[model samples]
Target: MAYVGAATALGLFAPRAWAQEGAPAAAGAVDGDPKAFGPERHGLSAFGELQYPADFPHFDYVNPAAPKGGTFSQVPPNRSLNQSFTTFNTLNAYILKGDGAQGMDLVFDTLMARADDEPDALYGLIAKSVAVSGDGLAYRFRLRPEARFHDGSRLTADDVKWSLETLKARGHPLIAQSIHDLERVDIESEDVVTLRLSPKRTRDLPLTLAALPIFSKAYYSAKPFDASTLEPPLGSGPYKVGRFEQGRFIEFERVADYWAKDLAVNVGRSNFDRQRFEFFRDRDVGFEAFKARAYLFREEFTSRTWATGYDFPGVRENKVVRETLPDLTPSGGQGWFFNLRRKKFQDPKIREALNLAFDFEWMNRNLMFGAYKRTVSVFQGAPEMMAMGAAQGPELALLEPFRDKLPDSVFGEPPVPPVSDGSGQDRNLLRQAQRLLREAGYAPKDGRAVNAAGEPLTIEFLEFDPGLDPHVSKFIAGLKIIGVEASIRMVDAAQYQQRMNAFDYDVVSQRMSMSSTPGEGLRQVYSSESAAVQGSQNLSGIAYPAVDAMVEAILSAKSREELNVACRALDRVLRSLNFWVPAWYKDSHTLAYWDAFSHPAQKPRYTRGAPEFWWWDAEKADKAGVKA
Candidate 1:
């Protein structure tokens, strides 16, 4: 129930910088007096500030003075980096531009970009500013006349037209559907481009347009747009692709004549002089490389590592520092997702019963060593989390669509914890579960819950990583104590991805990055069509009429208040389904960095996602002892 203060209320309110008839605001000056200058008055500080990476939020941090030569390795044990084609579809044209990864930002620039920390605020990068018509049916973007592709061709309205049309032409149906209302594109002039949308108000238009990465019309036209070719991607961003040694390293060097370099949004950001991403198949190797100073920072897991791993000689010498930033964003939607496509698990009672069996307290203490906490809801620490804490009178109105099909118990109150802590089960909960099981046509035979078909009530746990063994093992043991025949299955990341794409598993242990915008994400996790995308999303296999309607209501929402209503309604349906047995989240992000670096005094206002605006401080990094 914490409220954002007035300062933060106006903090993100930046004027649209695009659609201006003149040269884009000289690189980086947004909040400034264009006339204010000179060493006598302001100590010769440039119009804007620049600082090292990790200075911004939501972006991958790049060290400001880090040499352009070293390979920066990241170990993600969950999925493969190499996928020729994506099975899932998205409406964001940017998602279709490159192989979707945290590192892809190196090669693309969106019309309006988000600072790493502030996910909601839009900053101009491609288009200088964008203005929407009063009726909300038209949007205009003015390109910077100075902007040019990596190949040196001037960026124009034609590129903007091509980017939008190309997305519709080549983007998956699901991706194209979001922009289906985009009726026409008009090149008003050399720099101004206008889009006329269908009369139906689309709230996601700005978000969709902000996500489209402008490609060089000349570059894409030289050859046909092919997803398979790695033909040195050209971009107009602050960084350009340097080297592409497949499965080895991807390097991006700072753009010397980057046109947008002086913008307020870009100043004191992207401080990293050179950025390199090293890919590793094994996490252990990545961590080892990090410990050896092969990488500037490494986020460590495994209590044994956090508590004892730092005892290395490097730690004694203070070669690295470990820091934790409590989870501000959702730690990701982690839970046992049920595949509703399967008939066996179609019963609401079954999903409810399965959720009730977990002893999160015991699992947190005994198995996790207090390293984890139970997930309260999706988007755990976000401002608009539609969780139990925030559901109220208006919120309840949104859930009425599914009131008839869902149990009062699901929406009535949150479940109570068992009586004993790891010692014994609560008789009352057990009795209630037994009643529900019997009501659902399960019979108790020889102390086992079995259906009339003589099938034991069993649930399979599908986990992808070997790293998850300890946690999944503990969960399986808990299910056994509850008299459910829970079994665990382990598969490699690739195989697990394949199975998930097919919805071939009964229950899955998975995670998802939640967006700050609730409506867009709510649809991704719960909509009916999402359930059908195979591996597109909706890993829980959810398909419901109420969810679909709520999603539409949410997207059509005009004001924040209306969006809250739609969001809360969708929250109730998801909570009632218990599709996710939420897991714990770090209060803040954990980051390790070398000591020989300095950044802007301001706290980051963006995401901790990698490749952050660290390169902004490149001009002054050497003074901070960063070696290039």
Candidate 2:
């Protein structure tokens, strides 16, 4: 979960990934600045290559002529900030309080918008153009004169300045940590905003800043910016909060006169007339709701449901369509993260032993129907950033200084999760885990291990719902085999958020992916500073000088190649440390929805271009007996 501005990467959420497809710029890195900020650039990219020029029409991935006016509803694909998969209790998605409602990103606009077809390139959305300083620490954004909020008030540079200040001061800790290096925001004019960064800011800080959500100074001035509230905040995006309940469902109405609808950056996007998000405390219950058309769409996350649960009447009558779309973004990071804040999990050996106890090979076969591959790297699906074999060339050079701090295995071979013998209870692996526990000064007896002080090494697997009960129950049995006292704690969505913010759990599940152009966002999840922040995403409480140094290398990288090298070096060190029991991943998204929607021929390469690019098919909707 990376709202560290990821609501598809800004406004209310934090940065996640900025990847796309485009040929590299032939002019080379403009100003030798990684983002190609040379002379009133209308677009920005990590490697200075931008396929879409200033005068370009709509994005290649969109259908400019797509008809709008349809209802696209589903469960939230992924969540960040205070969002919950099962339930939500607040419309305030940016703060660290109640369970935030999904689809809040639709309510606000950013200074710039991402071109989904080009990796890491952001074209002007609300901003007309942007210019960067020679030192790459200052950015001047020229906002569109016509940009106006829902209440028809002109969105000025003043709003941008106030939003940034408020987010830094009272937003979620993740947002605060990601933008810690932002020095100041200077409003040059009503339509112009200048941002000054610290000299030590990350290379991608400019991009992250551009993608941040702009909030109305007037709307927030009359209300508390940090507390959760059911009242929707004012927004300037293509959609506005229409009708919503506290926790059950929320809907966003497309702005009939959306100021930027015809803009090149927004053409053929946000096609849904009404986008709705539904809540179900359980995955099985949600599936049943989809069958009954309680919601019109779903992106299936459970492998067993995809494999065997689609024999309902809707599927039999051809009213529902099921297909797999390729997920091109980096697998990012997904696993059961260990809370290193706890002393018992501070030992790397014990962490590794805990990781070894899970039989991924067996889980893939029996539980997941062999639909996923073991996620081995934090940059799991991204080849450029995944560390394989031994580090070499600039990657090795980057790690050379931290050799003494990192394990020797990081220098020899990248750590890989142990392959089980396909047995859920692999005795050999269990024995290996037991031996590691003993070496770590733990005594194993009676299916439980204790430290030298006789304190039982117990781990509470924390979760908000029973969606993972089958998987965790099996994993806990494996932990018992190795004398680790593991138990699962199922809490409500509200309690889960509170405990996560307080860092009170021994272990919790988290899934975060990276943008093609990774930068400051990584710091929110791995930097030592974030580890100390209460509501930050550094779930493992990673606070190491070596890791900090690696994060710095990533942030300061001057080229895509340099960034990849830094990521691999960091990945090597993280794997050796075993902060998580790496989970499984699939590169394709399994989708099942009613036959009431149609989409453009080409889908955005980086984002899950669903409701954003999908239009209503009146004929199909009639056949499916659904309301459009």
Candidate 3:
């Protein structure tokens, strides 16, 4: 609920420069003067002031005195850019051409690093400090004097400039689309870099630029930056690529002489001497591997496995431990997203029917063992952004301008997905769906639904894993009962990614994690521009002008209160559009790991700082007879 004061309400990241204290004497330049420069600030946040000040020794979420030395291995619980949870074929993780490996970012350093304890605050990592221009269009970063790559080469501001330009031109479609507003990167010297943004840039662009991975300009000069390759690129981070089998596993060895290891931002983190990720195409197989000690940690995503599969020998003997840590991050949009580009899914009326057809109550009780709650909003986990009973005050005013272009529900009580009568086959809901389908010009002809033009109303639910077949089958069954033809089409993970990038699937299930301090990421997920980008995350292909306008409102919000109002307005609009059949989300991370490790007293508010901040518990490993 904190709001930035009027003096700092420029919609720009607050200024912070590392190790630097006071500002130079000013010539009395006013606030709006383009020549005016802010004081050196050690960190930046989306809005308001930073959580940690410049002189803080280490993050409060970390145990700064904790010892380092251990091996932590697990399957990747989350992925970004081009990473795949199943397998990786390329070491180049920032492009769109390959199934990129997880943890590659561990080897690369960004100008600034996130304080996982805070919503969107970032502290200096490679850059010792950061400062912003008065007009809010430029950000200057001063590189740390000791910053060095794995090869002991001094990392420079020129490298940062090259990275910005290269990524904008050849990075993944999502990355490219997100950073398209970066006008230019000006290298003031080998240590200072200035990034100038376009006037049309989003409010969070400075943070985005600061968080971009710093690539070694020399290492990539000989190698093509756009190709898929197995060679590990040079980086100046805490870890470097260590051992790997192309498709099975990849390990990162902790850099003994890493330049920034003792920096406040990294203290007591990346504790393991070695970090590894084991790849598996199936969840059940991955679980079996965990039982065999193939991986030391597992963050369970399937509710059924959490309910029944944990009664193994390891659990009974206390060799394995489970932690139900609360996930305080936003569980944004998790659902079966309809590809709005598809002709059949263009009608909101039809999409609503599909949404109403999902029997979440019955599924949660029987199949999921009553593990989850039915999710309703695109901004489900972020309460600040979730639309409640009705729009009023700021939300209503912000949305009133687009009233004619939006559904009537935007002005009324938000539409909640129909509550299904716990009979897996809810006849009342099915009948209601049938009515909507009929109104949309689809009706039963010879026992199967078809449009007036005689086009059959069929939907293919695309999926990569067979474990979800049971879930998909039940939904298809409900659709069949309502006279619609629906079936599941299985594909491998790589194929699935390719199909998704090409927007070839009819409907696919996905979960999008949003920042508690939401900003520019909205464009990459819901904007009209992203809808046309091949590999962008706009899975639903949403391109409505109203949606784009709502996204702009969010970006332009100067305070936390304004941001909340904007997000709720967006949530109202997105829910009204019915672009997805909303799914379920649990606010807790169901973590099952070997009892061979121990962690800090507190977990980061925004991240599950497991294996990373966790050092090996020597006595626990010995007592439990588990492999470290």
Candidate 4:
């Protein structure tokens, strides 16, 4: 799944920002300093030099001469319950109340666009160049002269400053949290904007600010910035909002004279002449629509369906192509996260007991058709960032200060999730779980585990997707074997979002996607400060000081080696906590598309280009009997 935008990260408007209070600036000054950095450059990388230098013609992942005059259609990609919108109520995706339309980010351009091949490098888009202060507290962006909004107005520094201020004040909670350290926005000229950050912020502050989607301030003069509305706002991007029905479908038409069309960063991207998203209430109906050619492309996520359900005429006649593309980035962490705020789950022994009862081997073999591997670390998909057998070297040194506060096991080897012996009932694992539960004050009473007060140890697993029933049922059955009263409570999408924002569920299945280059976003997920926030991503309610310190170490890392050590330390500590029952992840993406669409012989190392870099072939569609 794609990294969810700031707006969708926080489910609702709580109007809270992260506090900026920490150490002072290291050293250096503005003009009189000899150590100050040079003038603005073309790109920025997190910890190293950029791969593509300035004046480069195009990215290595794209086909520079790829044509762009055919329509591309597909169902909107679903990341999670809150991230994916079933029915869009507003075109303004920055706000909090409404379900924003998918692909709305395509209507606006950020100061910098992330390179697909690299981990955390960003190439300039609207901004021609950017420079950082010697003290690393300020970032200045020089906008391109030819940048223009859909309304034909030039994009200036004032608009960029206004966009930052507006999003900080009235946007979603996650957006507000991200830019909370914005001390000020100084406009040096009509086309140059300087953003000053607080001394407490991380090195990633400038990059995150550069990635903000810039909107037009003049267009919103007559409209309220915080209110949810369907009126399309003016933006300076490759595509503009076109035809749309309220909730069924939305189309974006490519701008024929898009200003950045010839830029090095956008040479072979946004190839589709028209991009459309067709809405369906469920994935089953959407798959049927794809088979009928209602949409030109579809990404299959179900293992059962991918293995057995592709025997239709489209595949038999070679009209549809199925391909499994490898994902190079970290899959992040997906698992059954416990609500630590709940008193019942506060005991570490109980949490560990719950983790031990999950039968991953049996489930993978029988239900998933041996299509998945057990996820061992929070950063399992990325080898460099993941903590392996044991904590040693720099990683061990980083965790030394907090040794007394962490588990002793963290110093030896990272804990892997309990493995089952292929049978659904693993008596050895179940016995161990029972022993842990008993030690944690849970005892067998009337065939159910009960505490001292005669209250049964019951857990409710909240779910938004009905398709997860079979998968969740297996885990529920395992818990029952250990004398726990576990039940599944499936709710609608809206209710699920409401419950999630309020942190009302005892446990929920969630997938937290991490970037190849980790940064301050880690704080939002595991920091103590975010634990009490209404809509923060600290779903596990994690509040350990050790975890917070490790997050700081990661954010303040100055080199690639430092960052790796910090990530390993953090992963080791989190695994020891046993806050989540680790789930399964597939390394490859299962995609099924009509033969009409064609892509470059080489794919991006970090992402599936889909309709963005892939183009339509008229001759191929004609031969495949597909109506484009």
Candidate 5:
């Protein structure tokens, strides 16, 4: 999906794959001078040099010769509620009023495209080239003369400027907040546009602007931009809106005269002639549909379903293929996030006790079929960014100033979630949790935890996915054993988003995807300024000054080494806060699909391109008895 900003609360995809085919520019073109902005280039990376040069042919991960003529239909990934859509009321994915259709991002093209292979790199898409000022305050983009909207109108700087202003003023809360530091968009000419940034901004600000999806200002001139409507807006992407049944299904047809069909960044992508999204209310029903060939591809999320539910006839007959694709990117934060706004959860001892009470070992073995690993840090699975062993070296030096404000553990080995015996009830850990609770001014009264006010401790685990009940209920049962009254409250996707946006619940299940090159997005999650902003990504209600300082250090980092040090320091501080009950993550993507689709021998390390890069095979479909 097209994420609004860096710290996507829900439906966010990983950084786009990097292009590795082209060589870097000559030494004189650009070097280690932070004050010297280079001439217009095809791409920009956050910290270091771009991997692909101006004349690159195509991304290394795609098959430039891959055929593209068949339809590819499938369910969206099950990472977030925003990803799995039941119905859609609006074609506008940027607004907050209604659930937008999945894959709507396919209809609009951004000024620049991200490279999946690199940590933070963006190649020009709508714009032919981009240049940043020497002082890092102004960014100029030259629009491609050949670029045009789906309606055949020539794209210009006016459209780009209009998009920035409109989205900043009238878009969703997240979108507005993302561009809050964007001072203004200036139209230098018919083809060149310049963006002026506020003094308080990061180097990635220009790159973030590159990823902004542009819209035709003329279309919204006659239509309501903020309203949730089924009307498809005008776009310049490779795919145009085709047929749809409102919330049931939506199809996108490849544009024969797509302006950037042969761009270096898109040569092997948009392979499917017609791509469609089929929605199901429940995941089990969707699985059955996959078994019956209703959809051509499925990415399994449930471990039990993946382990035991794949023994069906399609697989036995060799008509279906199940493979695990390794994920090389950071496994972002996923956990039970506590609302620190609540007075009851403000105590550090209580937060630590709650983290200790949950038994991930038992849940993973019994419920997940032993198919998961415990998440250790915000940058879990990312070696360079994750803080390990202890805070030392540059990481320690960064934390030294905040020593008085942070826990002593920040200076020691980073805190990890408590590990328990696989027996479900680890009495030893429970005893330790009880001791912490007692120290936090909570005492066991009549076999229940009660505060100094004589009120019993109660926790409401707010969940949106019904499939999560089995897992959440187990956690709730564990809390009960620790003299805490905890119950699971299940709600639909809409209600869940509404409550989460308002910060109405005690605790909620949240999954936040992290970028390899972390930037301003960290502020939305860890900065004190975002804690009270409705719909902000600060799900844990974190307002610690230490975290805010770390975020600033990360944003202001000039070199890759500096960025890594700052990110590790931030990871250590956040881990030490114990704001979340860490969840589990798989290192690979489990995919099951009919044997009718073919992709390049190599997959991008950062993304599963799916229908974007995979082409359909008529002969394989015929042999497998699968209908397209």
Candidate 6:
């Protein structure tokens, strides 16, 4: 209840669906000096010398002039972009813990970024500098004098106050739940905005405050918040929404007379003349269009088309340029999800058995065409990933208390014992599965698993969106080998959402995109309270106490050590639960683009997924004869 209450206070009313998520370009050969593209690049003109802060970490960077007009096509999910009034909270970007539906962050601006890697931090945007009170209850934001919204209205303390107060009152329950104390937004003068909160809410204030998306009171007051109408969404950033077509694409035009055009933070970005997003319903169709030169670039792989079906002579002659970026992007977890709400899968043993039945080695090589990497824990191959510390000595000490809550072997070395295949077609894993099912009150008869009272144990592999339908179908074939009767039923986007919200799924396959913060991720995935709630991210429908405690501790952790300790404990408990069947990770990005484009020699790190940091070179683009 404490978890739910706090989440509500911060306007986090609903679990976020999957959404478009970015990459940076490495400073390579350019027409200008490489250092010219540092964070300070935008603040200086073409002739000015580059500047860097003393404390700023050195990053592989690039700087290019805003390229001429060109259109970038992307595949968008079928969902309503306008969520403010459609049973979804629009103002709760920060409080919601998952990758939200489309257009949340793209349309709005947050007070601060979730991490330092991304540029959303308002160092020179709206707030010049920020200071947190010693007790953490009070936060002071020093507003930049030149900050103004798209409508040319100067951003003031009232706008910030109104945005926060309005969200606290009318925002989602999750948003308002975390924020307590009816403290006032004290205007400490024209340039200073001080937010004072009660002591009870200061514990996790930074995480919550980091989510606040300060809106212009002037723009919103003129017209009510309505999803049906795409009135120019007010923003204090360098880009503003110019045009939007329902279920299509939204175009953002640069603010020509923008206040922060020369701001230090605004430099080196918004370099495109017009950022136009083209939406496609399917990825394959989009890829074909990319091959036909309809779009700027496409992430291609050695699938049926790339391996054998490249009939286009031009593309064949000038083969798609391939490059490998080393250890820069976050290799996200992509796999099938076991919905624990189904009584058939409520037993952890059954879930574990399902995980052991398939071989990732064969699947990646044959089915996936060697495009994926095997993942053990949810956070695999990530730096300081929780899985890295699972059975490590000191990390085990943190998890020792939950030995009873988890499998005994989990706290000991090697975590959960690996399941072995039984010999003679009745492998050790099959025997173990039979044992576990019997313990869960299942009986086997005539090569079929039956539940209590002679009902055949049937599990349906559900797919709502057709985007993942084929992959789900391929997985169901694997399940059949293990004597599980599995099938796929693809629903349209609307129906898929309805069924998902009702918790009407058996074994659903989904790719859960994670954030940089493990605390935020742990809450969304394994919390007991979140498991039961409709639209909750705990899609597994698991309710475990030890996992819950670790999640809370991780959320409230102050330093890196506390975070590491809590993460290891939570990982052990979650793996023992076995609610999720480990799947594959996309190791390499298979992008195919027209010959007209030249990319940066060095690839920028992708803390986010991919796409945000890619820039267009008008010179190379024109030389290649590509058009908008």
TM-score of each candidate? 0.79, 0.94, 0.95, 0.94, 0.94, 0.79
When summed lDDT is taken over every stretch of 10 residues in candidate 3, the lowest stretch is: 1-10
Candidate 4 overall Cα lDDT vs. reference? 0.79
lDDT tens string, model 1, 75-126? Answer: 3312212221112111122333323332445566767665454445455567
Tens-digit lDDT string for candidate 3 (393-432)? 9898988889888888988899888898899999889988
lDDT, candidate 3, equals 0.81
- State candidate 5's TM-score: 0.94
lDDT string, candidate 5, 44-103, tens digits: 776547778779899998999988788899876632323334556567778766777777
Of models 2 and 6, which has the larger lDDT?
Answer: 2
After superposition on all CA atoms, what RMSD does each candidate show versus the true structure?
Answer: 8.8, 3.5, 5.1, 3.9, 3.7, 9.5
Q: Candidate 2: lDDT over CA atoms? A: 0.81
Look at candidate 3 and tell me the lDDT of residue 64: 84
List lDDT for all candidates, in order. Answer: 0.55, 0.81, 0.81, 0.79, 0.79, 0.51
- 129-182 per-residue lDDT for model 6 (tens digits): 555443344556667777777776788878878888876665433345434343
lDDT of 4 by residue, 362-460 (tens): 888878788888888878787888887778888888899999988898998788888889798899999999999999999988889999999999999
- Could you tell me the TM-score of candidate 1? 0.79
- Please list all clashing residue pairs in model 5, or write none if there are none: 16-115, 16-116, 17-115, 17-116, 17-117, 18-115, 18-116, 18-117
Question: Candidate 2 lDDT, tens digit per residue, 1-628?
Answer: 1111122222223232221212233222475665554467787777666788789888998888888888999988788777888788788888888888888889999988987777777889888987766556677899999999999999999999999888888887767777777899998888889888887676667777788799999988878998878887889999888887767888999999989998999988899899999998877888898988899898888888888999999999999999889989876777899999898999888998988899888888888888888888888788988898878898889889888877899898898999999889888888888889999999876667987888788899998767778888989999888888888898888898899889999998877767767676677788798887888788889998888989888866766777788989999988888999988788887889999988887789987799778889888898888887
lDDT of 4 at 292: 92
